[model samples]
Target: MSAAPALASLQALFARAVVAGEDEAVLAHLAGDPETARRRLGLYRRAILANQAGALRAAFPVVARLVGEGFFDEAARRYGEASPPARADLNRHGESFPAFLSGYPHAASMPWLADVARLEWAAHESLMAADEAPLDFDALARVEAAGQPCLRFRLHPSLRLVRSAWPVLAIWEANQPGRDGTPDREEGADDVLAWREAGRLRYALLAPREAAFVEALARGETLAEAAGEGEPWDFGTMLGRLAGAGLLCAFSRGAAAPP
Candidate 1:
């Protein structure tokens, strides 16, 4: 193999050894004695797992608090072993943690825990999403009335929707530091709207119809189709509400769907 490919293969093997705790394959490639290499690999494995757990803890503080430190640590370790980080950006790690919690034996008792984790991930993603300039109303006004129906509206890059059978938004809010850990009512559904506003993360509960409208637009539906999703509701008012909230980022007069 060429130097580049040889180095790449070695790096991949090293990552697998550290992440999967299978260092034997990598021992032969190291410079030192096998025992010393094993010792160094063990240290690397511990440090990698610790860093991954720290990243998970940072990303899912609400989940960590709900499960307590000891439980969270064990769970984080198992999670790291099961789904090792595929990217260097640790901030983007643990996106699958909510799904992991759903099937986790210990977490089954707390059925709502997974959804809460999902909401937290949404909040994290919203905060990390790239910023975009708000929609240009003048450009929108220039489109003729006949061409408006097919116009595709672009919501803000940070906008995210999380639908849960449990009142996850309330649960998340109640668990905030210094707040009483009691949600208003625990038995109902919540469709949360998470987004970044003025550099701060914000979340709110969305009405069912409003969610449908937004979701349709998110799927690259045209104005006519999205407006139809909320029948009997004034599309103008709905559009105005989203635009006023700085949620509408841009628009395009074409049939192509959003990338």
Candidate 2:
């Protein structure tokens, strides 16, 4: 083989050995002597495994607690091999872990595991999402009544909406450090809206109408159009709750209509 192709195959083989916990025969072609090459390969394997485990653990502390350290460690090891981190930023790692857990054999017993992971991931994402100012009510007040139809509102950059087929909010709350006093699991689902308010991550469980209302607004529906999705949407109550919770960030007098 040409030098470039040979080197590329060697690199790929090295990565496979380290990530897949495979035999170390792949290192025989390294430039160094056989002994030196094997030692170097071993060092690379250890570092890769350690880094992957560390990142997974950091992202899923609650998962670790739920499953216990030993079980979680083994699961992390297996998952790391299957879905190695593709980015240098560890914070963005485990973005697909929630989905992974949903289908994992052991996790099937605890159907809520996936939803819990979803909630935690949402909080993590909200923390890193871009920041935006709360709605400028002052700007809205200055607009002409006739201009209301042209106005477009924007949600806060850190705002995130998650709807689950399980009681994810209750599950998350019950798992909280001091919330051990709650009753045993019940049957139901919940829709959660999370956002950063006053520099803190805050979340609220929304009713069907409320969730639909916010979802419509999120899709660029105007106050009038979005409210239309939820008949008798109680615009005053819904808007008041959202504004109070800092979900709405800013509004303009006129902008493009909803898609």
Best lDDT among the predictions, by candidate number: 1
Which 10-residue window of candidate 1 scores lowest in summed lDDT? 1-10
Question: In candidate 2, residue 154 scores what lDDT?
Answer: 75
- For model 1, the superposed segments whose C-alpha errors exceed 4 Å read 1-41, 142-148, 229-231, 257-259
Per-residue accuracy of model 1 over 45-104 as CA lDDT, tens digit each: 889878888999998988888889889988999887688778999998899989999999
lDDT of each: 0.85, 0.75
lDDT of 1 at 122: 92
Q: Output the worst ten-in-a-row residue range by lDDT, candidate 2.
A: 250-259
Residue 237 in model 2: lDDT: 87
Q: TM-score for every candidate vs. truth?
A: 0.83, 0.82
Candidate that would win on TM-score:
1
lDDT tens digits by residue: candidate 2, 98-200? 8888888987888888887888888888888887667668867888878675566677777778888888787777767776625356766789988887778
Query: Which residue pairs in model 1 clash with each other?
Result: none
